[model samples]
Structure formats: structure tokens, C-alpha cells
Target: MPLPTADTPWPPVDTRVLTSLADWDAWYSAEPERLEQRYEGRGSLEQANRPAQYAGGLRGRLARWFWGQPTPAGEKSSKLHIPLAGDIARTSSGLLFSEPPALISEHQGTQDRLDAMAKSLHPTLLEAGEVCAALGGAYFRVVWDDEVSDRPWIDTVAADRAVPEFRYGRLTAVTFWTVLDSGDTNDRRLFRHLERHEKGRIFHGLYEGSLTALGAARPLADHPDTAPLAAMVDAEGGLDTGAPAHLTASYMPNVRPARAWRHIPSAAYWGQSDFQGIEGLMDALDEAWTSWMRDLQDGRSRIIVGDHLLQSLGPGKGVRWEDRRVYTGLNMLPRAGDPDPITSVQFAIRVKEHADTCAALTEQAARQAGYSASTFGEHGDGQAVTATEIKARERRSLATRARKALYADPALSDILAAQLAVEAGFRFGVTGLDLSVPPKVEFQDSVTEGLGELATTAELLRRAEAASTETLVRMQHPDWDDQQVTAEVAAILGESGRAVSDPTMTGAEGPGTHGSGPVE
Candidate 1:
């Protein structure tokens, strides 16, 4: 076959950035780079045409969307990133957040991808493992799965590029790759070999990595938990065939209200690559993101409202966040009187003007926020609106939108999945991922009355029995102990025996963190 040419199209990218409204228009108008050669689809499909297949919250919706789609074998598939048309609103404060090239989907070439793409969401899916690249290690893939993935992402065969005139819109794109069991799609793997050239350029002004303990090492694309990333890495057992490497990135959802953020980005980072080693990748990202944030903050502090698009120098300066919406969706409800939901500390950078504006609007919204109580209109004292009232209004807005958005679509079974993903991002440290079907969180809680917390059921009892044995041995030998020597020794031996037999570890500090199945 022809050696992969340097002139080949770059690999898939999911980076989301904000360009000036004018610039964004320009980019859209710009000529297509390589598509003229192969894909010549008429711009008929658009995000609007596609149903918002996610709803039960982002996470569960992902699983539903994925499980619902039929994955062709041997490749990893994923939604590059999602774009909400709403963010581009004319809030007059926050600038637009855009993932140029709009939403995207891609496939990774790895063994994990091959296995993940071939199964149904079921109990045995977790123990799934595969070793493809058949004998002679030429062209073959094998997969053995034990657990079903909770969330899955599907991509349409071709994307609809032409969008209507800027009426303000959101876009979410996905990546789909061929899989081992997916006989027909196998031929698509060749397309992945063509995407390597389009990786995002490093921005010395923005840094996503740090030596700090909590810093992010990879972008959302490289995250291990992402089903798409796993499948991609395991494509055709690429590793077995010694394929060039790729990595996944981690993208934490910035659900925090845009107001609380010390800084906000005009756009969010969608995904990244795993090539060139973690350290090198980190090195390239660190300085750039850091500086970009700083600059945005520097410029945001001074907002001369009226009629203008926002801009920023970076972080750590004058940003009018009061006017920005912040991620109002992420605000937390801390207590009864406190205003504003406890938003996430992770902030992105936008402009100083945007910051101040966000801050002001948040305060206005908070002050105007309604609440509930025995009484409704008790005039006089300026004791801000009742929490119940505010919630009522918010709920109304949400309900109205839900009626229209896919959030309430009964047709798709992803509502639960989407809700889970959104919950995980907020509750757990997890972002949107193709979570495996919970596999039944069957908790054999110690409440099994007869078990008596004495090491509880099998696992815990075994541990307690073992500990008792040591105490008994010490007692049996007076010189080494306390209580009745011989009798205690007998009891200790008995407990020890039971421990060996049952082998329980109830109430032990905690069990292993790895999954029940062996590591691949």
C-alpha cells in the first residue's frame, strides 16, 4: 500500500474555541482543506435535523445513545464534543464559545475499542477483554466482554455542514470507527489513518497542566474512562500490530455558574491527543493556557457596555463577570438563606468585562430570586425573595424548555443516561463518559440481620475472626496475654479457621479500587 503520506489529512480534533463573530464567520467561509478529495456531501444535514439524543442528563443519555446505535467492528467511536447553540446568545456580556469546525466525532485504533464496540449492555460486559490481531498478527481482532458499557456515543455516517444564517445554535458532533465484530464497517478504519494531521496547535498562552497535585494531565480525549477513547486505542488490537500511539484527554464539565468563575474562557477545551508522551504534551499546554487566562482576565475588568463584543487580556484582572451567565446550571444550593448555588471552583477565562457583567447579573438574579415559606408577599424589610419562589420560577423555565428540548423526549430512552452523566460531573469528579450500565449496585448490606455486624456476612466476619485469633493466642499463653489462657486459645483457633474459610473483609478500611475483573 502507499506509505501514509505526510500530506495526509490530520487526525481528528475536538478543541472548542471562541473566535470573533466576524472571525467565526470568516472561518466558516474559508475553503475546505482536504474534504474536496473524498467526501463531497451536499450540506443538507445540520445539528437541528439531529434529535438531541441525550436527556436523562448527559451521562446516562450518552449510554443510551451509544447502546442504541449499532457499532461496526474494529474501531473506537466517540462524539468529538457537543455545542449548545444557546451559549452564543446575545447576553451582551459573555462572548461566544465555539468549537470551530463545529461538533466532531472520531475513532481511535486500539484493542479496547474493538471489544467495546461489539456488545450489548449487560452483566457480563465488565469482565470484557479482547486479544485480536489474529495469528500471524496480520489482520484480525478478537474480543471477550464481561460488562456492558453504561453510556455509548454514536456518529452519523456523514455530517451536515451548512448551517442556517447565525440564528444562534448549539452543535454536538460524535466520532464513529469500525469495530472487530462490525463486519461491514471494518473498511472505515482506513479513514482514521487520514485524520492524524489536524491536531490542534499548542497555545503557549494557555496552560492546562501543572506540577500541582490537582492539575490535569490529559484533555478529555485522553481520559481512560471515555468509551470512545478506549475503543480507539484498542482498534484492531493496534497495539498488538505495533500501531503508532494516541492518547485521550480529560474534559471536566464547567457546570459552575459563569459568575463564580474567577475567570471564564470564551470557549471550552473539547478533546486532546495522547501522542508525544504525557510530559511533553503537558509542557506544551502549560504556558499557553496559563497566559491566555491571564490575558483574558486583564482585559475583562473594564467593560464599556452598550454595543460591543467582549474581549479579554487573560486571568487575574478586571473582568465584569456580573453580566455573564456563568454556568447558572452548575450553581449549587448550599443552604436556606445563602444566595447562589455553590459553583465549581474550576473556572475558565473569557474577558474582564464579561466577568463584571456576570457578577452583576448574578447578584440581580439572586436578589430577584424567589423563595417559599408560609407567606408570599410580606412587604417591608429587604429580606431577599424566598428560595421557594426562585425555585418555582426556575422550574417553570426549565419545564418550558424541557418540553421543547430533548431533555423530555420520551421517544429516546437516554433521559436516564444524560441525567447520570450530568450528576456524575456534579456529584462525583467524573465528566460526561460512556458509563457502563451500573451492573447492579447490589449491595449485600450488612443489615442481613443474622449476619450481625461481627464482620458482617462472609467478607467482614472473616476479618473479625482473624483479629480475634491473635487475641486468643495471646490469652492462651498467660505470659503473652490477658483472659483465660487455654479456653481463649481454643476460641481464637476456631475464629481463625472460620476467617480462612469465609475470607470476608467487611468494614476493613476498604477493598481494592480495581474492578472485580482482572486488568487488561
Candidate 2:
């Protein structure tokens, strides 16, 4: 499809898409004000006026608690936000990338290139993974600049910033856009730079538009950011990528089906956000934390004194509590057997109650988000369990990580293949390298077995004569390649004097005889 032209609708996205993205972004940001604004914009006027009526379902109750019960004017309560949403996103990324995945290619040169790329792109991939988890998906675009780097580099675009075209649930093309300049609110002059990526070419266009409409298509040189790209544009207004069979961009969804927008066909291709389905639980968790803090604040002890006890500072000045040990001729007695004026008051803090509430909400949210409560450090009893017991506790989380890895592997393979294709087609770096095959993406295990446990298992296998030396070595160091394993096995045999020498054949003796003796 062609790029959006003049008078085209801005964003070209459904309202539901916008709303979902906005809510996910707000929660991922973990800003209390942002969340409050989102909740305020939802529901009806009656619901807004009577928050008690809003407490109907789980979400409504959470919203009521998070926004607080209706308070008198100028008596608004403080709300605190726990960054559990952000933590979930970060944990998702860490689970997948704490140990970088290996992009292995059969060809030696291609493997070398992949290794070099992985070294530089590991951190970028982690950041992209986090954003992907938070926003439901991310886009990987391959671009090159000889001035910046010799080879094509990868860039990540957040899901909200791009309009993707998919064929049969596969991404065919994507247009990434950014607002270069936004004029005054009244003027409504917006300069948008759009880069559309397709199989063999990238189209760049600048648009002078309003927030709701693309007013007109401007020349590339009209904007400072797009000016340099003017020199690269061909007669067709796109830079020929030279590789026509493959796309220069790929979409990596966080997870499949995008349950939140499954009803909306246009947005269904997007991935599901980590914060989806459990937003209310997270909000309630935040509310619990906020209420706990409020308890601390309101629990401070304060002395209640009569007007006679406080000394006047000066004219037009407020009275002050004199730091005196004793006062003479002061009215110490209460009127008509009333309570003492000098009584102290302090409210009790519901620590255990709030702690339990917060813990329960956090566990529910984590579980609802496809992770175990223990994944977020909510292990019951806080006991030190064996690795087997720990794995049992985090079975849900491990399964989740495996699912995410499955989704990521293909997208990563495609993008890395595109990168290699770009380099080989342009002859930019490492010429004559094979780019016909895409590399395989192998993610390291999220949970590694203890060395001692692995050694014991290997010993048992060896005792049963089931595992070979090479197999034992591989089990001990799963990260090692075949060559490393072979070398280690050979060294072990040689060091143990168990290396078998070829039997010598003597004419006098029978063939296949060992040493100088014949077969007995």
C-alpha cells in the first residue's frame, strides 16, 4: 500500500486501538497522575459523582479504592502507585534476556557476523523486549549508514508509533512515524516524518498535518530531519534496499491472540500486553500500599492542648507551643470532669492487614499476567527451598518464559536474516558471505541447574553406561559447541590414560591382535 497522502486521517488507527495503547502505556509508566487521568476519563458522569456506585465489579472496586472514596472539597487523599507494572515488564525482559540468545548460522562467515551483531545489539534487544512486553509488540527495522557504521544496524519502534500491514497474520509492511515539530496548540501545525518499510524498499515522506488530519505531503527537504534523506531517495521516492525477496522490517509480538482486542479485528494482530486483564488488581495493590503509607502519616503522635497552654508569638503572628518545662498559673483542669486538655493521640497503623492485602493483590496480578507469584518474590513463608521446589513454585513463570521465547524466536530470526541480506546485497561488510539462509535463534534456559546437581546426574548416567563422555561434558556445559565438547572429551581421556591405541597387526600373529600377542 502507498503512504498516507494529503487529507488522510491521522494515525489511521481505530479508537479502540488508541484507547488500549494509551491505557497500557499509562500503566507501564507507573505514574499515579497518569493512571488517575485514565480512570477519570472512563465511565459516566453519575459513576464519577458517586464512586460508591462504581464499586460493582472487580475493576470498579479497584478503581474506587485507587481513586479513593469521595472526600470533601480540599480534603483529597494521597494516592501511591507501586511500580509492579513496570517490574513485570522488566522481569519479562530479564527472563528472556538475562542470558543472551545465540544466533547460530551454519556458514562460518555468517556466524561471525551474527556474533558481532549480537555483542552490540544485546542491550538494545533487552530494551526492546521490555517495551514489547509493556506495549504488546515492537517493530524491528534494519537500516544502514556508512557514515555511522559499516553494516546495517537494527532499530526498534514501539508498537504505538507504527502502522503495520499484515497478510495472513504476517507483517508485510510497516510505516514508522514521528512528530518532528508541533506548533502552538491554536495553530495545529504538525510536521510528521514517516518512513515506510517494505520488502525491497523504504519510502520516506514528510507531512504537514494536524493531529486529526494529514494536511499535505511536503518535500523531504522541507524538514531538517528528512533533508539528509533527500539525497538517498530515488526517482520513485524510495531508496532501493537491493534485496527484493525479503522485508527489511519485522514485527515481534509480546504474546499471541491479543485477548484484549480480540473482538476488534484491526487490532487483533497485535500482541497482548503484560499488564492486560490484571490492571484492576495492580491498581488495588497500589491502593493498598497508599493506604499503608497514609496510616504511617496519620499515625504520628500529637499533643492536644488548650488555648491557654499555647503562647502568643506577636501581633499578627500565629501562636506557638512554648518549650517550657513548667507553666505558672495556667488552667490545668478540664471543665466539668472532662478529659485532660494535654492528652496525646496517635492512630494505630494496620501493618499486617495492609501487608497481607498488598501481597494477595500482587500474587493475583502476577498469576493473572501468566506468571507465578514467586516470580515476583512472593514465595510463601519466605523459606529457602531446594531448586526442585523452587522450580515447582515457578512452574507458571517458566512456562510463560518458554511461550514468549517461541514468539520471539521467529521474529528475531527474520530480522537478523534481513540484516545479513542487506549487508550481502549491498556488499557493505564481509562480502561474498552466504545470506541465503536465516540463522536459528536458540534461547538459553531461563533456569540453569546447579553444577553439583548436574554432576551427580551425570555420574548416575555414567554408572548406568547410558551417557557417553561427550554427553556428560555437554550436560555439564550446555553453552559449549560440538568442537569444544569434543576437545574436552579428548583431553579427559588422554589425562586419565584411558585413550585406546589402535591394535598392531603382526604377520606372525593373527590380525586384530593387541600388542605383540595373538588372539587367545
Candidate 3:
């Protein structure tokens, strides 16, 4: 598909897609105001008019405490928001990228290139992972600027900013856009820069538009953002990538089968968000925290006294409570059955109940978001545990990590291949590098077992005579390549004086010989 031109609808997304994206983005933002605004925007007149009906429901109750209207006293309600949504996104990213994946290729030159690229791009990939978790998915586009840098780099486009075209569940093309400038007062023009990726080409279009319409196509130079690209584009306003379409850009879903929008064909390709199906739980958590804080605030000790107990200040000034060693007797006497003039009172704060509620809500939210409570520090008895034990406790989190990696691996590999393809096509930094084979992205296990445990396991296997030297070596050093394992095995055999001569060769002795001597 080509880029949008004049008369095209702006953003090019249906209402469902817009709503889904907006909801996910709002939750991921972790801002109370944004959440409240989102709720208000989606709320109905009926919900607004009938406070009792609205506040009776779970979501309504949460809203009432968290981001609803001010309290009855006319003071703004104080709400404490626990940013578990943001934490989940960050944890998702950290699980996948805490230990950088190895981008390996059979070709040495390609390997070197990938290594260098990974070194420079690790942080970007980590950020992309977090965005993917939060936004359902992210687009990886191969971009370059000779003026900025010699080598082309992979750029991440948030899911909201992209209009992707998919065929048979595969990403065929994508149009990435940004609002470059929204013109000042009278004009009220919205200038948008759109870059559409297709087979062997990238189309760049600058549109002078309103919020809802692609008004007219403008020259790329008209906008500062697309001016540099203007010089690089061909006469048709497209840059020739000289590579396969899919190589230029790829869409990485956070998880498979966007369950929330699965019924909508247009949104089927979209990824599942980490915050999906847990918004209410998250809201309830924030509400619980806020209520707890309000308790603390309202529970403070207070003294009730008659106006006579207050000291009078100057004419216009208000009376103040003065802390004095002794108080003078008032002219008026108290009634026989009346209570004392002053009394101190403090409401009991429900500390345990609130803490338990918050903990339960947090655990439920984490679990609903496909993570273990332990992952979010909701474990019982805060004590250190072995890596194996931690893994056992965080199995759900590990499983979630594995699921995300499945979606990330291919997208990462494709973009990396695209990076190499562009590098080779433009002959940027490295030349003659083989692009025949795409790099493999091997994610390291996020949970690392203790070295002692690993050694013990290897020893047990060796004692059982159930594994070979190669297997033991691999168990000890899982990250080592075949060549490294082979070299290490040879060295170990040589040191142990157990090296056997090859019988196939012209040797003076048989297979049992060691250093040309026959075995006793």
C-alpha cells in the first residue's frame, strides 16, 4: 500500500483500534490524571448523572476514590497511584533484555557487524521492548542519514504512530507518521510527515492537514523534519531500499493473538498489551493505596473545643489555639450535664486491612498480566533464595518472558537482517559482508542458576556415567560454541593423560596406544 495523500482520512485507524491504543497508552502512562481523563472521555452521560449506580460497580467504586470528583467537603481527593502498569512493562523488557541476546551468524564478517551493531543498539532494543509491552507492539524500521552517521540504524516506531498493512497475518507494509508541526492560531494547520515502507522502497509524504483529514500534500522541504529526506528521495518521493519489502521494516507484537481485539480483522495483527484485562485491578490497587493514605490523614488526633477555648486575636484576624501552661476561667459556666470543654480524638487506621488489600490486588494484577506475584516483590517472607528456588517461584514470569521472546526473536532477526542489507546496499561502513544468511537472535536465560548448582548437576551426571565429556562441558558452559567445547575437551583429555591416538591414521600402535606406546 502507498502512503496517504490528499483527501485521505487522518491516522487511518478504526475506532476500535484507536480506543484500544488509547486505553493501553493511558494505563502505560501511569499518570493519575491521564487515567482519569481516559475514564472521563469514555464515560457516558448515564454514568455521570447516576453517581450511585456508577459508584456501586467495581470500576465506578475505583474511580470514585482514585480519580473521581472532589470529596463532599469540596477539597480535592488525595489519591495514591501504584504504578504497577509501568512496572509490568519495565519488568517485561528487563526479562527479555536484562541479559543481552547474542546475535550470531555463521559468517565471521557478519558476526563482527552484528556484534558492533548489538553493542550500539542494545539500549534502543531494550527501550523498544518496554514500548512493545506497553503499546502491544512496536515497529522496527531501518533508517539512515548520511549527515548524521555513516551506518544505518534501526529505529522504533510506537504502535500508535504506525498504520500497518498485513497480508495473511504477515506485515506487508507499514506507514509511520509523526505530527511535525501544528500551525499557530488562525491557520490551525497540522503538518504530518508520513514514511511508508514497501517492497524495495520507502515513500515519504508531507501533508498539510487538519486533525481528521489529510488536507493536501506538501513538498517535503516545507517541513523541517522531512527536509533532509527530501534530498534523498527519488522523483516519485520514494527512497529505493534495494532490498525486499519485509527487510526494510518489521512489526513485533508483544504477545500473540490480541485477545481483546481478536474479533476485529484489522486489529488481529496487533499484539496483546501487558496491561490488558487488568485495568480494573490496577485501578482498585490505586484506590486502596489512596484510601489507606486518606485514612492516615483523617486519623490524625484532633481536639474538639468550644469557641471560648480559642484565643481571640486582633479585629480582622481569626482566633487561634494557643498552647499555654494554664488557661483563665471563662465568664460563662458549663451546664451541669455538659461534657468537658475539650476532648482529643483519633480514628483508628485500618493498616493491616489496607496492606492486605493492596497486596492481594497487586498479586492479582500481576497474575492477570501474566506474571508471578514474586516478580513484583509480592512474595511471602522476604528472604533471599537460590536462583533455582527463585526460578521455581517465578515460573509464571519466566513463562511470560519465553512467550514474549517468541514474538521478539523473529522481528529482531528480520530488522537485524534489514540493517545488514541496508549496510551492504549502501556500502556504508562495511563492504562485501554476506547478507545471504540472516543473523540468529539467541536470548540468554533471564534466570541464571547458581554456579554451585550447575557444577553439582554436572558432577552428578558424570558420576551416573549418563553423559559424555561434551555433554558435561556443555552443561558447564552453555554459552560456549562447538569449537570452544571441542578445544576445551581436548585440553582436558591431554591434561588427564587420557588422550588416545586415532586408529584410522598410520600409527605405530593400535587404538589403545597413548603417545605411541601400547596400553599394558
Candidate 4:
């Protein structure tokens, strides 16, 4: 959704539903401190003078593992082992795991209390509904492969060796939402909630192209283990009926792509995939997403839990037969990412300092784990390892070793600068084209000692059309702040030369100057 811009403004947010700008702003503003912390912290340093520091604290979720290993026999399942509190009071076969099942221990009292059981089970059913609701759809990756990946093509080979075809995919989110509307309650069921519109949406997403008739599809037993749990309830008992029905729903897929295409134009910008792959990647993005939607709608209802009354109680008439039990399980997802703002900034910034060669490899690892076109990311999204683990994953080579050996030398930053400059020019299509910059004859300032005025790297190249006397001197510094960024950008604009320096980094380079530099 294209949200409203701050200046354009919007109306007050609806407290009932997220309907206005203030609500959205409240949602978005919770994290602005991350940015402010980044800007305020850290000073100037040589971009190429130091070894890459380990991502100390602020790496968010890593991707997840998605082998895409095929579903088998047209029947797929993921196990969830739930923790339990106690044994049931009874046991039976083909049990419904019915709503309002008795929780009173046989150890306490085996007789009467049918009304109490109903009252107690009513809340238990309600609690189960609440727990399901708390599953909270926050993170799940599904996407189409980007057409521009260095690797070409992916075959979604099913367990039966069926090859589904497609190409483009980027990361996408998977979300769930429940629907509520008036529905006639089943005499057996005490509660109900379903609206025509919500059902239509679910049906449309699921049965769009399926050949099988919905009626003919077999409903899966809620849980096989629950069948043996029916012994606790009295065969003919229980009273009271008013209760709200509970159901689960999925909202929308949250596609946190490697980059925000609209906010970001170039690959060098962090928060997106660096310059990799081609333009056609967006094409394959749809199928993977819609297919999953289809699966969710068609298969979900069949597996949902619902209670069916085998027999009913006559008005004011009851007996001493117990009839309910519960034998199922549930699971929850843990949180991921760094808690502090400074750490996140550093993690992303460091990725850039390395020119992103390593981050790419990490992404490559994600892909191999089953994130092709139709998936957002695999691995890491849920994994929250410390900086130690991240740094351990960095790429190493003999050149890195030599570079490390000369860490203290001034020439070292120069060498690192050369390498980064080459990468920046090569990947971002930004060469050190010069503009009419002041001659680098002097470099004395609070920001930097003995640096001169700055100009676009492009302007410096046109010696005939512009200031030709502007000389460029190269100097390396580390830091990502106002003064440091200003100077680095000045250097970057004058980067066409072997050594470019401008201590007064006041001039923000037009366009391509990301100022993610020591001199920006």
C-alpha cells in the first residue's frame, strides 16, 4: 500500500480500525530512533584503513531454512509437540476433542457437575481460541526469484517429480487473518462466526483453478491422538449453550523484499539487495505467492477443529455419562533481531564497508536453503546469533590476510579505498567523474586538517568545459557523521583522481553520494 507522505497529511486515525495517518505514523515512528542513533553515534575514520569489525550486537533476523523438499503422497504435515498438564478423566474412540470438554480430574470427583463442566469447558474452548489467535502472523518468507540473480532458473520439483515452472521471485511475507460474521450455530456447536465476504475471499484464493469439487474433498480429522480422549465426559450430560465460536484467519503476506524498489534506486544502498541479477526478476513473483494462498484456503478448513454433538440433552433432562477429552498440541514462534538501535546501524553499515562481497555470499547461502523466486528469504530470519557468529561467517582470502598484516600503515587505507572505489564504480555505475572542485592545495579545518573545497566527480573530468585547475588529493578517514560524510562525499565527487581529499565535507554530492562514507 502506498502510504501518505508526512507533509501531505491525512485525517485522524480510527481507533477501531487503522484508518488514518496518525495511527500509521504511530506504527512507523516506533523505530525512528534507530536512524537518529546511527547519525549521532560514530565519528570519522579511514574507510579502507581498518579490518572489517565483527557485527557486534545489531543484526536482526537471519534468513530461514527452506529446502522446498516436496510434500509426500499428496499429504503433508509438520509436527508440533505440545506440553501437557495432566491426564483426562475418560477415554473413548473417534473422539471429537469437543468444545467444553471436562477438565475436572477423576481424582477429584467422577460424578455430577455436568453444568459446572459445561461452564468450565466454555472458557477452555475460549482460551484455546485465544491461543490460536496469539500465533500472530509477523514473519514468514515467500517470494518469486528475482530475474537478475546470478543463478538462473529454479524447478519446484514436487515429491512426485512434478516440475512446476516459473522464474521471478523476491522475498514476500506470509500472514494470516481470521474472519468474523453472523452464522447460525450448529445445534452441536455452541458458537459460530463467519461472514459471506470473508468466505468468498478465502474461496477465491484457494479454489480458483482446482479441479476437485469442494464437497468431495475429505475433511481431515482434527487430530488422531484426540480420538482416544473422549472417555472423561458423561455419555448423557452438560447444560448451557451460549458461547462464541472460534476460528483462525490469515491476513496478508508481508513481502519484505531485499530492497524497497521505490525508496531505493541503486543496489549499493543498504536495506536492499546490492547490485545483483537483472531486470526480469519481478516477473516470477506472483505465482509462488498465489499458489500458497490457494493451498491455505483449500486445505485449511479440512484440518480445522470443530465439535459435533453425537447426542443431545432434553430440556432439564440429563444422565451420568461423560463424553469429552482433548488430545492435541500447539506451538509458538520466538522473536528475532537485535534490541538496540546502534547495533543495527553498525551491522548494516559494516556490510557496506566490506563493499558487500560477504553479504552476497550470505544471501547465496539463504538461496541454497530453499529461497528461490517465490520466497522472501530462508535461514537467518528467525536466527538471532551474536556478532561473533556473524563475523565468523566473513569471507577470507590471502589478500585479506596481507591487508590485515599492514593494518597500521597509511597505505593500507589507500589500498582498501582503491578496492572499494573499483567496486562502487563497477556495481553502482558511479565512476569518480570529477567536477570543478577547488584545488587540493590546502587542508586545514576542524573536520579535517589540510583539505579543500569539493565538487562532483563528474565536473572534474570536463577540464575543457569547467574548472581544470582543481587538483584532487586522496585522504582516508572513518566515520559516518555530518563532518566525515561531507568530506568523504567531496572526495567521492573528486574520486576520478588517484588521491582525492576535501576536509570540508559541507558539499553534499548531487545524486549518487550516499554519504555512507568517512568523507561524505
Best by TM-score: 2
Better of 1 and 2 by TM-score: 2
Q: What is the Å distance of residue 7 in model 2 from its true position?
A: 2.1
- For the record, the alpha-carbon RMSD of candidate 1 to the native fold, in angstroms, is 26.4
Between candidates 2 and 4, the TM-score winner: 2
Residues 397-504, model 4: lDDT tens digits? 222212222221221122222222222232233333221121111111212222222334434554555332222222223224356555655555555443334344
How good is model 1 by TM-score? 0.18
Off by more than 4 A, model 2: 41-77, 182-188, 314-318, 323-339, 380-386, 427-430, 481-483, 504-520
TM-score of each: 0.18, 0.88, 0.87, 0.14
Candidate 3 lowest-lDDT run of ten: 511-520
lDDT computed for candidate 2: 0.82
* Superior candidate under lDDT, 1 versus 3: 3
Q: lDDT: which is higher, 1 or 4?
A: 1
Error of 3 at 93 (Å): 1.0
User: Relative to the true structure, how large is the alpha-carbon lDDT of every model?
Assistant: 0.25, 0.82, 0.82, 0.23
Candidate 4's C-alpha runs over 4 A off are 1-282, 300-377, 381-388, 391-520
lDDT tens digits, residue span 372-395, model 3: 998887765877678889889999
